[model samples]
Target: MFSPALLQMILVAALLSLLSAGKLTASDYYVATTGNDQNPGTLNQPFRTVARGISSARQPGDNVIVRKGIYPQARTLNLANPGTADNYISLKAFEEEEVIIDGSNLQKDATLIAVLSHHIRIQGLTVRNSQNIGISIWGPGTRVHAVEVSGNRVHHCQNSGIYAGFNRLHDPVRDLLIEDNVISECSLMNEGGRYNQWSFGAGAGLSRKVTIRNNTVSHCYGEGIGLYLSNKGTIEGNTVHDNFSVNIYLDNTTNTRVSRNLVYSTEDQRFYRFNHPASGIQIANENYQGFNNPSSHNVITNNILIGNYIAISSGSYQRGGGLKHTLIANNTAWGSIGPLLHIDADTSHYKSRISNNIFKQTGNVPLTDIQGSTARIEFSNNLWHGGVPQQSARSTSDLEADPQLINGGSFNPEAYRLSESSPAHNAGIKLPEVEQDFNGKPRSKNFDIGAW
Candidate 1:
């Protein structure tokens, strides 16, 4: 056998030869509106259409970089090519240039961008005016995994802004990272259309190990951000507001954590007057046909909710599956029009723990309206104030007094922070799962009562 040094040199030479022959190297394809598809996809000679550039990027680590321009597609931009576990194919705007994918000319019910494969990264693209979903990352009858959709602006879609799911339960989508996206003005077609008012700003269903964080979602027809039939998902640090229905909804989800989110509705109820009431967060089991998953083992903590019809709720909408083993803690809710927490009567298998929350109301509305059996629920160490006929009897350790939050009556999220001398400071029972406050500060051994 050859020496080790000689063998390394030979291997390096072979790799150099392969790269020189364009055999083992990733490629970058460019698209520009002023170019033509017949030209080579390069910086100077770029493809005219985004489809041409994406089609040319057929290998792992390939990038389809679109220049600053508006490319209106008459059909869906189907990203069917996949990368490997170690390498990801990316479709992104070129070097901070604005690339708008306008789907105004597309056929009805067609999505703007359809990610049909795995190990894909779609970033920094503005997608708008689609008849259906703006960006849909799903595979029909197949499983899609390891997709990252970040820093995109998706708006004016007739349906959901961004969605990832498959109808088949066994072929669930997995490992999605959707973060730092601004999604608004979606679900425009839900106004008495074929969709039946079921659109949202951004949502994922039938998926696992999904992280949706730091997104701003607003003014949608349905829930701002929803997770349905999904498990092991984290919905964190999202600013969701002014949606028609629930701002953040967990339907038929298990082992999900919704934390540190800012959810609220405007005082005028801008888009909320159309359909469902303005709810900050809702956990339910809708029991869609063939999917009987229940909402269980979920944690909602460190969130700030303001001016919603209901701050947080749990229920069984279809009367089949129900919420169980839920933990609602370390949240601050204020200025709710109705009861801050509402539990439906038909909720089967209802068992939850509510603690370290600040439920403050401005009117005579009760802090909670529990129509279900409350025997299984444990309510403790919460601060309740400004509601008539308070529900303090349920918890022996609960305090009925002003939380003394900084500017507590304001709609600003920072206004709910606990002051130095506030009664809520260091008054909460320690929850092991909640190690940080709403502002991402580490909680001390002596915990605070509400989100700070």
Candidate 2:
């Protein structure tokens, strides 16, 4: 038998052999504004342009650290190299410095940074001023999975600030994470042009397990954060506001979860004459030629929808699309001119549940919740301000008393906490799927009526 030290030496020799053969070897390349491409991409002699770093030879676990400066040469930080799952190709700003990749003058392409490969991590940078998309991720040839686009500021784009789309059903951009980023002032060209696909803060297309969380997406011309033909992901803990269209939109999605998001002010100030919809949250069959597919098996929970044109809605086209096994629970909505919850579909056979939500409208608009026939309506324990149980209402367990909300008339919408003496303090039926309250706190022994 070989000795333990001898065995370890043999393994180390094998690893060194692989490194010498360039299979397990990874490099650290640097880029700076004062660098020269002719120099070796080291700390002292870095590459001048992002394209030069992209053109360099890189293996898995390689890093391209960009220094702090304005990269005037608008170029595509293309990911042509694939990384391993354990060790990804990292493209990050130097020590959390401000690395601005400005694409204002670039006319060659619509996207600034393009992710064509797999297992890439792009973080801690500012991507802005593109004609179309600020950062575009497309799995063109093979499957591009496990990409993390985090801690960056993506804004001021024409169509979408960040668009991750994969048309190939087999090879898709799956297992993606877009978190903790500020995406604002996007979709400048497509203001209220929903049919034109003009503007969106962030969008995911034809992907699975793509989480969009802990981000601030606001002031866009289209949806603040949209999932088009995408399914099975969590859109949670996001502050989404002030979009021309829906603040958070899910089109043709299945088994999706949207929880603990602060969605407010989906007001179309740009094209008010065009009469944009501007719903706070929409789960529907629209966009991307996917209007007819079944948008079912979804959950919208623990969201705070405030001061929007419409709080929540689900729309179906003429092609007979609808929702099934959907749940809208524990949300807080106020100051909406339209219906608090409007669900319309072509088919009468729908199964949806609305429970433990708060509906308080300051305006005189009628407080109505739509339900189609054959819908398993569970509208119970909802706290409505100045609301009376009507004959047309379905839930007999609902309460028509004041919720006793706090500081709702103030400038800060986050002050909609339930008062200690409020009727909404502990009046909800807690679902097993909903473990945390809207404030991410542990639910009390008796759950609250609406989102905290």
Query: lDDT score of model 1?
Result: 0.86
lDDT tens digits by residue: candidate 1, 264-360: 8776444755443578999887757887667889999999998888999876567445458889999999978778888776535556788999998
* TM-score of each prediction: 0.92, 0.90
Tens digit of per-residue lDDT, candidate 2, span 60-96: 8988889999985456567878888888998889996
Model 2 vs. true fold: TM: 0.90
Among the numbered candidates, top TM-score falls to 1
Worst 10 residues of 2 by lDDT: 386-395
Clash counts for the predictions, in order: 0, 1
Q: Rate the local accuracy (lDDT) of all candidates.
A: 0.86, 0.78
Worst 10 residues of 1 by lDDT: 387-396
lDDT of candidate 2 at residue 439, scale 0 to 100: 74
Off by over 4 Å in 1: 1-22, 140-142, 192-197, 268-270, 273-277, 388-393
What TM-score would you give candidate 1 relative to the actual structure?
0.92
| Best by the lDDT measure | 1
Candidate 2: the clashing residue pairs are: 187-199
